[model samples]
Target: MTNPSSRSTVLSTSLTVFAPAKINLVLRILDRRPDGYHNLWSLMQIVQLEDELSISLSDKHSSITLQCDDSSLKTDPSNLVYRAAAAVLEHSGRVIGLDLVLAKRIPMGAGLGGGSSDAAATIIGLNQLLNLGWSREKMARVGQALGSDVPFFLFAPSAIVEGRGEKVAPVRIKGSRWVVLVNPGFPVETKWAYQQLSISRTGVRPLSDVHITLGKASALSWESVLQAAENDFEASVFKAHPTLHRVKQKLLAEGAEAALLSGSGATVFGVFRDETAARQAQSSFQTEPHLKVYAVSTTSDF
Candidate 1:
């Protein structure tokens, strides 16, 4: 039998988790399956920027609290964090009510996987407290049920994700490229972006998932990579919101080695080879009243 002393220690413990951000270098949508999910392949990378979540046990009962710089989001059960906590607790058969606190730093709905990352972090923390001892694969299976991007956080390290985003493999795309993330103070829904896509001469609808095509892509020069940087959904997305297109152009105009839409974005990023160029581009955006800019770097992993 377990000692009461050990049990008390477990119940009073707390944990804080850091959930990072993600950027999709390429987003390609393949054929839609009868299951209602569009097949996708993406080259995803993590960034230094992140959201912090602080979780603890509720003395009174299961509880949750969330505070953020933005007051717009409801910090309650409707939030993904709530759903995630509920799932983990229920799965563990633990009656212990939790006090889950999420501090949102990553921008919401900018295609940065902010919410999904939070969900993933919650699962991990709960697994530790609840002694779930789940393998990365098992955790990913649970996370995939929450969001397509959640699985990445489970196995975290840059990955090449395919097949509705569940299949992941470690990829070696070299360089710690500097990044400038620009959020235009506008939110773009991934669903909305996909809905706007239509088959066009350039394959605007992206009938196939992304292909790395060139394997071990570490040697290519930045300029050449820019020319090859492909986002099949970009054509449709940019067409609807011309400002987004302009944002991509501006990143280049400011001297980014490569500029592309990050996921289905209202936020775009510029990749630079050096900090000097990255900082210069950030300063250049000081006059843009409509956009929020952040300096970031490519993570060694997704």
Candidate 2:
């Protein structure tokens, strides 16, 4: 541990980083793990929607402070923010306290990878602020240890994530087009979603399905491929919440290109042809008391 207040301090740093939310176009739990985690492969895309993180130099060695609008999420060591800072310290050997502020726009436990994104932001923010000069690859290694979804954030936007979600292969899918995201006022526990994956009994795998509307890469962005990609977690999640299942149907009826569960769900997203249609869908869902809809375009920059 080193004193951070001194001008001569080596690791004292300050920076502000934006932590964005992530939406999974598809999630498939391939297998159950002995470690109580399911092996999964998913199509993860970044949305323009995000939360803000403010971190600055502090006096102690590695103290972390977090403030957020959600009173329910623990701001202590239980928080990924805290854990992420610890992870950076354990790796970098730079023991400097951090003054962190969390502006939480992303719903906690909404299967949006908000917490994991924030943790990744902290690691990157501190790395640059501390002048450690770490590369993207190094940050990704730290991110993978933090969470399955975290590593994807460390890469370029629009990646096809595989394995336990650590492997990321960048796929160039352009256009900041619209997507309709709905969280039905309930958080879906990822662990519970995995348990719902009864692969042996169900004896089926969800297929991937791709649809093309309008984008720069016109020829390749065909409909058949997108339709083939699937989220295996959807059936069980929808079975548990009949209302959520209905929302997915409604979005499709509203002319969404594709309607499917995002991540482990309760938060389902409908990919639309354009932003106007997405906004219209959002307006339609506003009448529902329990549904929270966010009309966002795809973006990987945080």
lDDT of 2 by residue, 1-302 (tens): 01110011124355667766777765666656687666666667777667777777787655767776678878898788888888888899976777777778888778888988888888877777777788777887988887888877776466667778777765555555578889988888987876676732465443323312211232224253256446777778888888888998999889888888888887888888788999999998877877788999764343
Report lDDT (Cα) of residue 119, candidate 2: 86
lDDT by residue for model 1 over 144-173, one digit each (tens)?
Answer: 888898887766546667888898665555
> What lDDT score is found at residue 210 in candidate 1?
19
Candidate 2 C-alpha error for residue 47, in Å: 0.7
The residue ranges of model 2 lying beyond 4 angstroms of the native Cα positions read 1-13, 33-36, 60-62, 204-225, 300-302
The C-alpha TM-scores of every prediction are 0.86, 0.86
What lDDT does each candidate get? 0.73, 0.72
Residue 288 lDDT, candidate 2, scale 0-100: 88
